[model samples]
Target: MTFSPRRPLTAVLLAGALLAGTAGCSTFSDSGRSKYAQGEGKPAEDDDASASASSSAEAELPYDIRPLLHPDKKYYGLAAKGAPASMKSVKEFASSTGKKPNMIEFYSAWGDSYETTLAQNAWDYGALPFIAWEPFKRSLAGIAAGKDDAYIASYARSVKTLNQPVAISFAHEMNGFWYSWGTKKATPKEFVRAFRHVHDVFEKVGATQVIWVWSPNVINPMPKVRLEPYWPGDSYVDWVGVVGYYARTGPSTFPTLYGPTMDQIRAFTKKPFIVAETAAEAGDRKPADIKDLFQGVEKRDDVLGHVWFNFDKEADWRISSGPASARTYREQSRSSRYGFDVTKP
Candidate 1:
């Protein structure tokens, strides 16, 4: 993430409740169903009338899943971390960038009864939704054991309503020691089982519109907890997303920061690679770092895309934090390879 939850580690927000109710619905209430859309753990029909309206979306149904993996197209996305998850706000943020993001990123937590409002809006705006689903205050083992099926099923149906393709990444950065699912607190077995279990439920409920992204934090800093042991395999993933940043000062190149980790990932799967979260901290080389970061990834044929973390915390990571940095980004995005062509409804 561009920024993390301050309480992901020790916060047990769901202490006595099995799940959040209407009182805590997420940014998905635009359709009024996110609040009352309950799952009895069974597939429910939306009726002939609703289905008729959805027929158009259904025809547009199989939503183009190729852009994310197009062999010749390079996709560029954005993650406005800590910002409102509404489409209106998302558009305003993108407008400020002088470039629109092909994908808009949002966040969700385990047992957090949320809806797909952002996803719907992103689709309407021709942008793919990239959801960063977290497993806070819960153990991976419990999720893998089918304890979270009802919640997962409900989410699946909601996406089914979306009727457009969306990308879902669960427990991102599992190898990092900050969250409960990190290597120090959970085993690789638990992580793999939980991921497969969630994907299986999504499959069972017929939420095939989803594009699964197996995301992990870079391992150059922690070789002991290699990302390979935690991978759920090709059949379970459609994309390989990695998160790494240039947090230091002085001049540096992209390979210097991400080459070794990318090499390690190549040792495993050939899934399309996405720099799910990346930024250059405001330091001695903030301007140069931004230039190298964009140019470096732009030159890689194997990189499907890159998402910039547009936030102003923990070292002014926002592109506008520095004038030179912002200018470089705006100019670089003018390239034809910085794909902004999205599918709109």
Candidate 2:
């Protein structure tokens, strides 16, 4: 999801200059290697843990598909029971459209208020579980900050109770200026420390029922120099997820938005990668744009899935829901961009 213009504007202006200097290499010595290691343990250990987790990592759906946030607007408390026709349609499409189960993102705050609604709906709908939980927002803000300790603990318990394999994404988008985690003047080391600290807490608490997801924005449009300080070591992250989107205000093509960051992070880590959140505006966003985004990176074996940012605010000026988006997506199936036919490729 794109951040409000108020904060990201400055980041955008600085991107070009930063890209030019990515050529000069920076050393990640003491800060990157020490301190945080004490609390989170050695990166080697985390790496081995992640590797073992991968060997037996629960098998993913045959074709990658995450429905993003709840389709039923009701979960947002914006619709009454059975009122979101669009969401309902998308749910049916995902379940019946293919043989495999489709995944969906479950935002953390929403969990407190809408878990029952989502759980009930998820059970009935046959939506594959790719649960994406964001607990870091409240925690880092000092709002939740481990106080209830029992709160996230309870949330983890609730998720585990669901008995579905899920991916818990805490404080994602760490590499971008939009989120609170990345907003401060944090060096990569500091970011790494903060990231590991949170994960360590989860591990200490015994929340292994879920997979750990470390997601960051594709290379910030800002230059490389400014971006280097954000690379927390590759060891701590289990699955590498990236948020990439196409909008009129930004780059014209999907690949332009996703390519560089996808390539860079892929080079840095061996973990499975996901286009965690992605979409193109409906009207202004040609079906071709969606195809292009996937087309560019479809070949990467490391690339595992694509979760559309089915939010309504960032529209293509035409469609307001997933049904319309899916139609446009299928209509353009003849193109190379439509490489996700579950039956074949």
Candidate 3:
């Protein structure tokens, strides 16, 4: 779950900068109100005949993310520095792995404007944009009490205006104690309330295009803290994102790392899970660990995919850290079962 924190500078600085230039901007007014509203700001219902007609009359978009909702093949993704903004690192990763990633993962701090450029870049590159929306300076209790409604509403509207599918993993790795929203700073009840509140705001603004991913760090490191207490119910979650890493001191095999966590999750909900963040350490055993990572994902039907933490932080976790590891990654990840055209049906 650990990687170099490369916050998107352009994205944070130029929030909503694309709306005025993009063709989708035509559907919104200068006030940024959605055209879907009718009869003096009445919200449109899915079953409303007029609303249905309005939706059909909209121009066709290039990105179609339904395929990613229930992907027949595992998603090949990467989390690297300057991704979705530059894609230089992503391209290098693709070159080494012999295939372009179908999903791009990035981090977004709270109070920053939605990174429309990041989303656009991911779609333009034939990939899905996955955001790890971290509420760094904000308190979970204050968030739940609607103190941040204005900010949340503005952010959600930006996503709605884009009208493209995006996956958001809000306040990820909450089960761990290192982060502000984790066990040390916040309670499970407070976390659940804050999560539900954010999800509700997005729903109220008709940003239903988002795929809500509830991610938590693996339980192996913190066996004392249970994950069930933080559950925000099934309605608010579309995917269970599990975060873990293969380290020399930690669990090296997939079964030892993710099995117990997955087993505990199955006791509550049947939602499909993904290895949201993972990487192998740099060492002689990295090649074998890399092979095991790919093979482990390939054999699990419920595992949607994994996003490799391709950055050198704390340890050499990059895929190209060593010749043998790089070669093994290229060879093991060539499976036809790993990546697919997310834009296609």
Number of the predicted model whose TM-score against the real structure is largest: 3
Cα lDDT of all candidates, in order? 0.68, 0.45, 0.79
Per-residue lDDT of 224-251 in model 1, one digit per residue for the tens? Answer: 7787889898999998877777666422
- For model 3 the TM-score comes to 0.85
Model 3 Cα lDDT, one tens digit per residue, 268-298: 9888898898888789999999999899988
Count of steric clashes across candidates, in order = 1, 9, 0
> lDDT for model 3, on a 0 to 1 scale?
0.79
User: For candidate 2, lDDT tens digit of each residue in 26-52?
Assistant: 112233323334434544224335544
Order of candidate numbers by TM-score, starting with the best: 3, 1, 2
Cα lDDT of candidate 1 equals: 0.68
What's the lDDT for residue 319 in model 1?
80
Rank the candidate models, highest lDDT first: 3, 1, 2
Q: What is the lDDT of residue 314 in candidate 2?
A: 27
